[model samples]
Target: GESFDPRSSLYLYGNGDGPTSTATIDFAAATGTEYADEVENVSFRINDIDWGSGNHTDVVTVNAFDA
Candidate 1:
């Protein structure tokens, strides 16, 4: 197997027809260290209070879009 790591993480954003909704990621506020790889399983957890009052549950996954 090969090892893969991410230098930095990018903010995932989503756009809607009515308004432009955004997600705030506080990687710095994370209690522990997080790492990513181009190939492998990944996961994400939201600990920020500013996200919302409702369940902000999510499934973390990454995929390669280009060769």
Candidate 2:
């Protein structure tokens, strides 16, 4: 079992006023404990502020490697 809190390590940048925004997460910089033999599941929760009225879309990607 393993767990990490990405709040301190995650960085978000890019033009919010524009059509797109980008968020980058640095797992290496994260301040937490992690231990896992195999990744059985992954989850993400995104929060937005002052999102105006319009159709919006979200895309998420995760990269994993065997150690």
Q: Name the candidate that leads on lDDT.
A: 2
lDDT of 1 at 45: 38
Q: What C-alpha lDDT values do all the predictions have?
A: 0.40, 0.49
Model 1, CA-based lDDT: 0.40
Residue 65 of candidate 1: its Cα lDDT?
44
Q: Model 1, stretches more than 4 Å misplaced?
A: 1-8, 13-53
Highest TM-score: which candidate?
A: 2
Residue pairs with backbone atoms closer than 3 Å in model 1 (clashes): none
Using Cα atoms with residue i matched to residue i, what is each candidate's TM-score against the true structure?
Answer: 0.19, 0.29
